[model samples]
Target: MLHHQAIITDIKAIIAQSQEKAIRTIDHQRTLMYWAIGERIFREEQQGKDRADYGQHLTAYIAQALEPELGSGFSKRQVELMRQFYRTFPIANTLYSQLSWSQYKLLLRLDSHDQRTFYMAETVKNNWTVRQLERQIYTNLYERLLVSNDKESVLAVAQNEQLPSDAKQIIKDPMFLEFLGFRRESAFYEKDLETAIITHLQEFLLELGNGFSFVARQKRIHIEGDDFFVDLVFYNRLLQCFVIIEIKTAKLTHQDLGQLQMYVNYYDRVEKLPHENATIGILLCADKNDAVVRYSLPAGQKQIVASQYKLYLPTEQQLLAELNKELYSFEKGE
Candidate 1:
């Protein structure tokens, strides 16, 4: 009986694997079909550039003839999208097999070539679902990362051209915690925020950036007969260091920085292996004054970072403004 059950399990596994493979094959074929159609449409439009209305008339004619026979995939709007997809990609080799038609549709909406490239590389690297890709795009993950790192460096890291050497490369200054389901107007304690983060740990790690795995919550330490609890402990594989996070429900102060620094010191001296890099301390707070953060930490300090957490995602305008401010600061050598 046990042998029969084992055989059944093996067969189920094989069936599931084949099903997934079939789905992937279908998705890839659909992508190729769309690309081919788009390429043909673009070629036809080029041949009729002399006639301004010819391109419009051609699309309408094709859609009118195909929609009823081929379903709404060939609708006028979708046909336009296909044309745009060809024009945007230009090279057939650039389209990745891992990305589905839905993912491509979302990618088409991005206007910047760099942004599209970054998202493409990230989506493939992380094996992000269409929904995950959409969330990252809407949350302005690219813009947020740009706030700390230069464009070339950011793109290089995303494309796997280089591993991140600095914590700032992977970490964002104002991290979004909208997934925690916290209300913007509501008051919450540090413990409440910490509990929420622990409950929604996976989402927190996604927002925290790449290579992070949860280690502990309220991790206790002892020094000279005194005990203290660190709010959160994480290990980043890429950076090869322990990330010690301290949550602050109020605006950041110099005292908060000091306490986090102490935890970082303890982790480095006690918990960290000699082969690992220095522990990074992140002060996740509700609000922070840049000047306070700067002066609070020693000059040329890289280990401690104070990042603000928002209950809601910022608007495009707000992210743009933040990016601009960071750029200005960088230019001024701040």
Candidate 2:
């Protein structure tokens, strides 16, 4: 009986795998079909280059003729999108086979070439679904990463040219916890936020960046009869270090930094193996003063990072303002 059950399970697994492969194959073919359509439309437009509105008229004419026979997929708006798609990705070879038409539509909305490239690489690397890719784009993950690192480093890491050497390469400051469903106006304690994180741990890990696996929560350590509990502990495989996160619902102070530093020291000395790199400590706080964070840690300190957590996603304008503020401070060599 057990052998028969195992055979049934194996057959089910094979069927599931084959179905997934068929779906991927169909999506890839659809992407290729769209690309071919876009290329043909673009070639037709170029033949009438002297006419200013030729491309627009040509697209509408084609859409009207095709929609009657091929249905609404060839509507004017979608046709225009196809034209833009070809313009955005001129080289057919550069199109990623793994991305579906829906994902490409979201990518088409981005204005910057570098931003598009970064998202494309990340979507493939992370196996991001259409909704996940949309959320990342809407959250402005590319711009958020750029706030700390340079463009080249961000692109290089996304392209897998090099492994992440520093946590800052992947971690974002002002981490968004809106998915935790906490209201911005409501008051909450650190434990409440921690519970919310634990409940929505998967989204938190996605927001936490790559290669992070949960280790423990409220991890206890005893030293000379004194006991202490770490709020959250995680392991980052890429950086090969343990990440200790301490939640602070109020503005960050030097004392908070000191406490986190102590935890980091303990991890380095006791928990970290000889082959592992130094443990990293992040103070996830509600607000922080940049100067205080700078002066709190010792000179040339790289292990401890203070990042703010937001209950809501910031608007593009707000992100721009924050980016500008960081850029101004960086320019002053601060």
Best by TM-score: 2
Model 2 lowest lDDT segment of ten:
323-332
Top candidate by lDDT: 2
lDDT, candidates in the order shown: 0.90, 0.91
TM-score of 2: 0.96
RMSD (Cα, Å) of model 2: 1.4
Per-residue alpha-carbon lDDT of candidate 1 for residues 1-334, written as tens digits (9 for 90 to 100): 9999999999999999999889988998998888899899888888885645887888899999999999999999999888888889888887888899999999999989999999999999888899989988888788878877888999999999999988999998788899999876998889999999999998888889889999999898989999999999999998999999999989999999999999999888988998999999999998999999988889988899989988987787887787678778876878
User: What is the TM-score of each predicted model, taking all chains together?
Assistant: 0.95, 0.96
How many backbone clashes are present in model 2? 0
lDDT of 2 by residue, 1-334 (tens): 9999999999999999999989998998888888888989988888996645998899899998999999999999999898888889988888888899999999999989999999999999989999989988877888778777889999999989979988888998869888999875998889999999999999999999988999999999888899999999999998999999999999999999999999999999999999999999999999999899989888878899888888898886887788678767665777
Q: Tell me how far the alpha carbon of residue 15 in candidate 1 is from the true structure, in angstroms, after superposition.
A: 2.6
lDDT of 1: 0.90
